[model samples]
Target: MKLRERLEGKRMLLTGVTGFVGEALLHRILRDLPDTHVVALVRRKGSLSGRSRMEQVLNKPIFEQVRERYAGDLSALLDARVTVLEGDLSDVPALPNDLDIVIHCAGDVSFDPPINQAFQTNVLGTEQLLRRILDSGSNAHYVHVSTAYVSGRRRGAIPEGPVEHDADWRTEAHWGLAMRDRIEETSRAPGVLAKLRRAAERDHLRAGPITSAQDTERRRKEWVDKKLVEAGGERARSLGWTDVYTFTKALGERVVEEVGAPLPVTIMRPSIIESALETPFPGWIEGFKMAEPLILAYGRGELPEFPASPDSQCDVVPVDHVVNATLAAASVLPEPGTPAYFQVTSGARNPLIFARLFDLIREYFDKNPFDMGERGAVRLPIWRFPGGERVERTLVLGERAHKAADFLVTHAPRGDRVRKLARELDQQQRRLDFLRRYHDLYRAYLETELVFTDDNTWALFHGLDPEDQREFSFDITTFDWHYYLVELHCPAVTESMRKYDVIRRRRGRSAPQVAKQLPQGEGIVAAFDMDGTLLSSNVVETYLWLRMPELDGQGRAREVGALLRRMPGFLNAERKDRGRFLRAVYRRYAGADFQELERLVDDSLSQHVLERVSAAALRRVREHRAAGHRTVLITGAIRPLTRPLEPLFDEIIAADLAIDDRGRCTGFLTRPPLVGEARAAWLRRFALQNDFDLAKSYAYADSHSDLPMLRAVGRPVAVSPDVTLWREARKGRWPVEDWKTSSSVSRLTLPGANGGSSS
Candidate 1:
C-alpha cells in the first residue's frame, strides 16, 4: 500500500507539534494526506495560547512549501483538517474517542536536566499519556518517538529491540522524583548556608547588607541546580547510560511496554537528526542542533583540537529522513499486544567516518570562512584528533594561565592602556570557556563506539510501492554526505549565527527614546551617574587637574609617585567599598587652600571638565528638563569640581570637603559619601519628600556598584557599562547605550539656562 493511502481519512493525535521533528511530521502529513484530520497537542507558552503559538509555528520557513501549495490560505487548510489542543503530557487532557493513531513525540530532550525533571516528563509523562489513551477506549496504534542512544554505553552493534536493563521503571521513577526534596533539604544545612553567605558577601561587598542577603539566596538556588545536574549525570552513568536524557528515554520505552497493554505499539528511534535533505527546502533547519555548535565553533577558529578517533562512525540522519521513517512506521499498524521496533539510522548501511566529516567541514570553511569583523577571515585549524586526556590537560593549563593574566591586569594601574588589555583578556577567557564547555558536553558522543542497526526500517521502506518510495524515501545509502555538510548544513548554521549577531548589534545600539517620552510633569525625574556615564573624567583625574599645577617638576614627580604607590590599595577599596575609596581619595586634598582650589576649578572648567562631558548625555538631560522632569546629578566627585556644572542640573548632590578655620581643606568629608546602597536610599527619601513618583523616573549608571540605585528606578539605562553591569542589564532587558566624550565642546549647556551655555 502507498504511504499516503494508508494514512488517508484517519484521525490522528500528535504531541510536540511545536518541536522540530514533530512540526516536520505534521507538515508532511498535512501536505501529503489532505483527507486526514490531525489533533495537535501543544503546551501554552508565557502569555501565548497554544492555538496562537500553533499559528506562529505554521508561519515558519519550514511550512513555506505547504503554504504556497495552499496559495497562502494555510489558515483555511488548518481550519478544515487540523484541531489544536492546549495540553501537556504530564497532565493529559481528554483524547478523541475516534482516534486512529497517537504519535507520542513530546519529552524532555536536554542531555543533563535535573533527575526529577527528566523522570517527570520522559517517564511519568509517557505513562500518563498511555493511561489517558486507554481511558479513551480508542484502539489507536501508539507510535512513540525515542532516540537510538537508549542503547546506552554498550560499545557494539545495537539491535532494533527493547533495551536490556535490570532496573524497574517504577522504582527508578519514584527515586528520581524523591531526590529533589532530599537535595532541597540538604541545601539549607548550616555549612552550606555559611559557604554561600561568604561568597555572596564577597560579590556584593559594595551593595550593602540587604543586597548581600538577596545574593546569598540567589546563589543558594544556583547551588541546588548544580547539585541536581551532577546527581542526574552520576545516576545515569551508573545505569550504563551517557546522560539523563537517554536513561529516562529508556525508562519511557519501558513505560510503553508495561502500560500500553492490549494495544499495538511502535517505537521509532532516530539518530542525531540534522538539517533537511530535499523535502520542504534545502538547508532548512529550525535552530542549532547537536552538531551545528561544534561545526560553527570550528568554522570560527575557536575549537583548536577535538577528542575523537579517525575510524569512529559518526551516525547522523537528516530530519526529513526521520520524519519520513516515522510516517512510514505510523502507516503500518502492528499486531495487538505486540510492539514493533524500528531504528532510523545511517551507521550500519552507510557509515561516515569522523576523519571524513572533519575534512568536509575544513574544506567548507576554507572556501567560505567566517567574517570576524576586524579579526579578518577565520583560518581553519588542522585537527590532530588528540586523545581526550591530552585535550583536557591543555584546557586546564590554558585556564590557569588565563587566571594569572587576569590577576595581573586587575591590580595594574588604571588607564586606557590597561583597560584595553583587560578587555582583550576577557574576550580570550570567554573563548577558552566555550572550548571547555564544548569538550565536556560532546566528548563522549564524538568518541562513541556503538553503531545502531536498522534492518526493520529498511524492510519497511522496501515494502512501499515504487512511486511511494520515490516520494518518501529514507535511503541512507543514496545520501550525499559531502553535499549535505558543505552546501546545506553548514550554510544553514552560518545563517542562524548571522541572525543572532544582528540581534546583538541591535540591542547594543538601541536608544532610550521610549523611556524619555513615556512620563511627564515635575514628579518625574532623570538621575545621572557622573564619572563614567556623563563624563570621561573620574575623581582622581579631576583632583589631579587641580593639584598638579601647584607643584614644580620635582614636586609633581613626588606627587605622581605617591599616587602610584597608593593605586593598588585604592582599587581594592573601590571594589569592596566605594564610600571608603572616596574618603581616601579626598584625603589627598588636605592642607590645600579651599579658595585656591575654587579658583583653579574656574580656570580649568572649559579645558578639563567640560571637554570631557558626553554630548549625548547633555542632550538627554536637556530633553528631560524641557519635559518638566527634574534633573539630578548624583556623583561621588567633590562639590568643588561639580560647582561649575550646577547650571546644567536642578540639583547636584556631590561629596563636600570639611574645611579648617583658615579655609584649608581638612581631609575629611562633611557627610557620608553617596554611593551604592546609600545612594539608592537617598534617592528613595528624596522622591518621598519631593512628591516624585519613582516608577516614572529614570536612572543611568555604568558600574555594578550602582546596581541598587539602578533597581530603585523604573527605567534603568546602562551607559557604557562594565562587564558585571552589562551582564545584569542583559538579564533584565534594560537598555544600554555607549556615550562617547565630546572633546570639541568646551561648555556645558541646558534647555532653559539664563545665559545659554555655562563655562
Candidate 2:
C-alpha cells in the first residue's frame, strides 16, 4: 500500500516538533495525511508550558500555510490530531502501546555542547527510547534522523548503508560509558577547578565587587559549563567528527542499529537542511542556521575572507525533501534481521559547487544591500576562497600587521592620519578574529571533499507510483541550485535577519527624548569635559591655528610677532600652571571685536568640530539624557568655543573674558580660571548652591589635571586620556574609553606587526 494510505488513521509518535525538520514533518502530516494522529514530544522553555510551546511553534511562519488551510478551524484540527508529551527523552518510561510508527527526531544540535550533554541526549536517549519500544512490545516502524556529516572526514563517495563495526569500533553502551567517565574525570580535575576559580576572580575584578556568596557560586558554575563545552569540542576533533553534535549523532545511529535489531528500523541521514522548497510553504526558516551567519556577515561586509575548497559540493537539501525521504524510509519496513538506510542529500544528484554558491550569494546581497543607518549602507565583501593553508597564512600576516599598526599609533606623532590608520588596523583585526573563529569551528567541514550517495533514497522514490511520487517528492535530481539559493534561500535568510534586527533595536536603549520643560538646579548633573572627550582634538589650539591666516590682514602683526617671540615663556608658564597660560592666551584677540571672534569660533566649530564629534561621547550623553540627568559641558576654554554644543547639554560652564562696554575684548580674565583645583571647587559650590546630591553626579575628563574634579564625583570616566591620565585611570580602576576614535578601532586583534597589505 502507499505510504499515505497506510499512514491514515495510524498512531505516530514524533519527537523534536519544535525543530526545523520536525515542524515541517508535522505540518505535512496534518495537511496531507489528515487521519494520522501525532503524539509530539516538546520540552518546556522557561515559563512556557509544553502545550504553550507547541502552540508557539505551530504559529511560526513555517506553519503559516497549514494555518491558512485550516483557517479558523486550526485549533480544532490540532486538538483532534495531536497529543502533547511534556518532558525530555531520557525521562520517558515507555512508548505508547498502540504506536504504529516512531520517528525519533529530537537531538541536541549545538555545535559546541557539553561532552556529557551531547552523548546523553543523542546516544543514550536513543537507547532508552528503543528499549522502551522493546519493553512495551510495540511493533512500531522506527525512523532515526541523522546527519550526512556522520561520514566524518572520509573522502570519495559515501554509501547509504549501515555504519559497520571497524577495528576501533565499540558497542554504543561502552562508548557512552567511556565518554561519561571522561566527562566526570574532567569536571572534578584539580587543575580544572583551579582554572575556573582564577577566571571567575579575574572576571569579577574586571567588573566590580563580587560581594555575595551566591554570585560567586554562579560564576563558578558558569566557568565549569564553559570548560565542559571546550572539552567537548576537543573530544569531537580527536574522534574525527566535525563537531560534538555530529559525533554523538553518529553514535546515536549505532545505538538504533544495535537495539532495534529485531524491530523494523530505518535511518535517514540528511545534508545541510535549508528552508522548504515545495512543501508546507516556500521561504520558511525558523532561525539562523549554520550557513546563515556566514551569509549575513558577508552581506554586512564583516567577513571578507574564508577558508574553503572552491570545487567541493555544499551538499544542501531542503527540509521538505528530508522529511519526505524520512517518511518514505519508514514506509518501506525493513526485514526482521537487517535495518534499512537512506542518505537524503543533494550532492550526488544536483551538486552545487562552492564557487557557484558564492557567486549567487554575492549577486543577491549586491542587488539588496543591508542598511546600517548613518554609518552608510553595507557593501558586500570579496570572497577569498583560496585553499585552507593559504588562507591561514594570510590571516597570520594580517594579525601581525594589526599589532604593528597598534604600536605605531601609540608611539608615532599624534595627528588625524595616525588615528585613522589606527582605527583602520583595529577594524581589520576584528575581522581577522572573526575569520579565525570561523576557521577553527568549521575548518574540518569546509575542507571535506566527499559526496554522499543517495541510492536508497532514489530507490524509495522510484518504488512509489507516479501519484505518490509527486505527493511525497524526495527526488533532488530536478532541484535548481541557483534559483533555490538566490530567489528563495538568500531572501528568506535576509528577511529573518532584518526582522530580528528590528526587534533587537526596538528593545535596545535609545537616546534621551527631549523633555518639554527644561531641567532645573534640583536635578542630577552629568558633567562632561569639552576638549578631547567630545571633539577629536584640542579646541583651543585648533581654533588658534585656524585663525592664524585671517590674523595676517589685521593690524595685529606686531602683536602676533611679540606673542611668537614669547612662546617659550608661555610654554614655561603652561608647565607651572595651565590656568595662567590659558588666561594669557586670550590676549591674541585683545583689540578685536568680541562678537566677531565669537562668530569666528562658531563658524570654525561648525566647519571642523561638528563632524569630528566622538561617537562614544555622543552615545554616553544620550544615555545620560535618557536617564533624566541634566548634562553640563565643563571646560576651562571660553564659552564661545563650547557654545555650538549647547543643544546637547543642559548648561555650559567655561572661563569668561572681561568685555568692555563697546563689546570689545579685554586681555584679562574676570575671575581666576577654572582649572585643576578651581574646577573641583566650582563643582562643590555649584552642587551646594543648587541643592544637588554630589554623590549621585557623574564626571568625564581626559587630563590628569582634572583628577580633582573626577575624584569629587560619584561616577568618574576617563575619555581618550593622555599617557599620565591613562596610568592614573588604570590605578583607580576607572572606566576608560577612547572617544577620539570609533569603537570599531577598539576591537581585539591578534598580536602582529603592522606591515602588510590591507585585507
Candidate 3:
C-alpha cells in the first residue's frame, strides 16, 4: 500500500481528522491512495488557550502515523491537498465546493455519553454534512464512522448492515435509582487547580481497598452513570438530536437516508476494537475503553469477581483490520441510490468466548513474570471485597493490601492499618466526584449482552484471497482476544500510571524515605513556642498573647495561624500567590524540631507543659530527629509551662529557673547569655566550645526576636511564617515550605496550650 497511487489526483474531506479512527483512516487513505488531497476541518477556537485543537489532537501517540505522513508540514497539505478549515460541523454551509468523497469520522463514541450532544453531531451534524455534499453537486461519496453500539435499543444477534429504524433515545436513568450524594466538581469547567486537586484526590482514593462487595458494585454502577453526563448528551436536545449517543448514532443513519437519498454513503460499523497484531503494525492502541476494566481489575487482583456471565461472547476487532475494512469499503464500493452498509464486527460465526478472554489474561500475567518493582504485583484474593460470614478471610485479603503493602506505600511511612483505610475512604469520595463530573459518558455506558453480527462483513472478507483476508478481513474469528486485550490494556494503564507516578503502592522501594527515628546524639539547646504554632492553642487565647506580647507587637501569632488554615481555599483564587507563599513556609519550617528531644518533651516535660501536647510543635521535634540533627528547646515560658511539649525536644532552655536536687531554685541561667546579637553570639560561641557544629545546629522560635537565633543555623526555616521572617526570606530567597503540601491529612489538631510555652 503506497500513497502516490490512488490520491495522485483525488481530493477528500475528512472531519474528526485528528481522532483515533480518523487518524488511522487518514494514514491508510494516504498510503493506499497517494496524491489525494485531504481537507481536515478543525475548530478555530481550540483549547481556549492558544494551541490549535488540531495540534493538541495530533500530539497524541495514536496519531503518529498521520503526523509522520504530514511531516509536521500539514500546511503543505493544507495549501496543496490537505486544507485545515477553521470551522465546526454544526456550522451550516459546511462545504465550500463539492469533492469526490466526504469521510465524516467525527462524533462522540463514549458508551455512557450525554443525552443531547449524542444527537447533535451523530444525527444533525451528519444530516447537515450530507446536505452540503448534495449541494456540492460534485457526485461525492459520503462515508460515516458509526459505532457498533448504535444498536442502542436492539439486542441479541445484530446484523452487518446499516439500520434505518427510528430509535427511542434514553434521556433518563438506565437503572432509575435517583442519585443523592452528588459532588460538584469543576474539572470539566474553566479552572485548572480546582480540577488538579480534585484529580489528585481521586487518584489518592482509588489506591485503597474497595471495602465490601456491595460497595464495589454500587460504585461500578455509579461510575457508569457518571460517564453519561460528561459528553454534551444532556445539551444536544436543543441541537435536534435524540438525547442518548447510541440512539442518536442510529438516528444519524436515518438522517443520512433522508438528506443523502441520492448521495453515495457507506456506514462502517465496528465492534469493540482493540490493538493491531499482524497487519500494518502490532499492538498499537489509543485508550483503555471497552475491556480495560476486566484486564486491569484482574491484573490488580481486584477482579476475580465477575459482573457478567463467563459463557457470554465478547466480540472484538483489530484496529488495522477495521482500517482495512474502512479503506476497502471506500475504495471499492460504487455510488448507489442507498448507502452501502458494512458491519466490521464479531460474534456467532466470528466470536471469541469472553470466558477464554478473561482466563488467558489471568494466566499470562501469572506466568509472564514481570516485576513491578518492590511492592510486587497487585495482591489478588480469591474474591473481591468479601465480608460478614467470610469476614475473617476478607480480613486477611484486606491485610495484604495494607501491611503486606509494605513495598506498596511510599512518601508516608507505613503505620497502623487504620491509616491505609482512612486514606482509602478519602480517595474514593474524590473518585466518585470525578466520575460524576469529567467521565459522565464513561459512567453511563450500558452493560448488557451487547453483541454484533457481521454476515455481510464476513462475506466481503471471504471474497478476498487468504492473503487478502489477512490484509483486509476484519473477521473477529481470527482475533486472539487475550493477546489483543493485554496488548491494548497495558499501554493505557501504564501511561496513566506514569502520568500519576504513584510510588505509594503497597510495594516498591520508595524515594529516599526518612523515618523520624529516635534521636541518638545529645543536643546543646532546644527552642520552642506556644500559641497555635507550638501548643496548638486557640489563636485568640489571651494567655498566649499575655506571655508573648511581642506577638501582639504586630498581632502576628494569630495572623500566621489564620493564614495556614486558609491555605487550600486560596490556591484556587486570584490570591494564589499568597497561598503559594504560605505553602512554602509550612514545608520548610512547620515541623522543624530535634528528634532526640521528642521523648524528653513527651515524658518529663509534656505532662506539665501547662496543657496538652500540640501535635504541630511535636512535629518540629520529629523533623530534627529525622535529619539526625541535635536540638535544644528554648522558650520564654516556664519549664512546667512546656512540660507536656518537652519530650518532643532535646534540652529545655526556658525563662523559668530549674530546681536542683536540693529542690532549690538555681537562678543561674541554663541557657548561656544568649540574647539579641548575644543570642546568635553566645549560641555560636557555646556550640563551638561544646563541640556542637555551629554549621549544623538549628534554632526555632515563633517571634521576630528569634531572627538572631535563626541566623545561627545552616538552614533557617520559618514555621507558619510571620511578616518579619517572610521579608528576610525574600531578601535571601531562603527555602520555604508548608508541611501540609504533601498529602491531605486528617483533622488538624486545634491549639490547646495557653500562657504561651516555647520549647
lDDT of 3: 0.52
Return the TM-score for candidate 1, rounded to 2 decimals: 0.86
Best by lDDT: 1
Which candidate has the highest TM-score of all? 1
> Which pairs, if any, clash in model 1?
none
Provide the lDDT at 100 for model 3: 73
Question: For residues 1-759, could you state the per-residue lDDT of candidate 3 as single tens digits?
Answer: 322333356677888766667767766665455567777776566344212665565565554565566686644434654566676677744576747777887887765454444555676678777877777677777777787766654457777666645333223222211221232232223463344444333322211122122334454445444554533354333333333566667767777766776877788887777666554456666666566655554565544344334555666777777877776666545566677778777666656664666566766666543345565766553432232225334334654555444334432321334334434643443433332332233322222355676766676666666665665556666655555656554554445553443543453321222223533455434344443245434222322322232244355556556655764554332122222322332222222122322333444334333334345446766777666655566544434445555556656555433345654444433443223344556577667777776554555543334556676775565554444344454355554322222232212322223422332
lDDT per residue, candidate 2, 1-759, as tens digits?
Answer: 787886778889899998887888998887788778998878788999888888887777656666776674657657887888777776765567888889998888867777777777888888888888888888888889989888777889999886543413245335544665565566557776666556544322212223222335675566656666776676666767777777778878888887888888888899888887887777677787778888988998887677888888888988888988887777777886587888888889898888888999999988888877656678777776878898889888888878786766655544446545655765677788878878877777787889999888888899987888887898997768878998998998899778876676675523222233424434677888887778765534544533453444452366456777978787655545667677768766576676876766565444344555787678778777877887888887777767667788987888787899999878776887777666777888888887777677878887766777787887677776654445456557676667765534321211111211111
Estimate TM-scores for all models: 0.86, 0.65, 0.55
Per-residue lDDT tens digits for candidate 1, residues 1-759, read 787789888999999888888888888887788778999998889999888888888888767776776688867857887898888887889887899999998888888788899999999999999998899999999999999999988998999999999979999999999989998999999999999999887767777767889999999998888888788888989989888889999999999998996789999999999999987777778877788888998988888998888888889999889888888999999987789999999999989989999999999989888766556788888999887899999999999999899878755644446656767787798889888877876777888998899999999999988998888989898877899999999988898776776675666534333454645588887899899889876677667667766776687679879999999898889888889999999999999999878777776554456667788888888888888988999999988888767888999999999999999999998999999998899999999999999888999988878999999998888887766666577668788777888646432321111213322
Off by over 4 Å in 3: 1-8, 45-74, 77-81, 162-243, 334-336, 368-374, 381-421, 428-451, 462-470, 486-534, 539-759
- Give candidates' CA RMSD values in order: 5.3, 12.5, 15.0
What's the candidate order when arranged by decreasing lDDT?
1, 2, 3
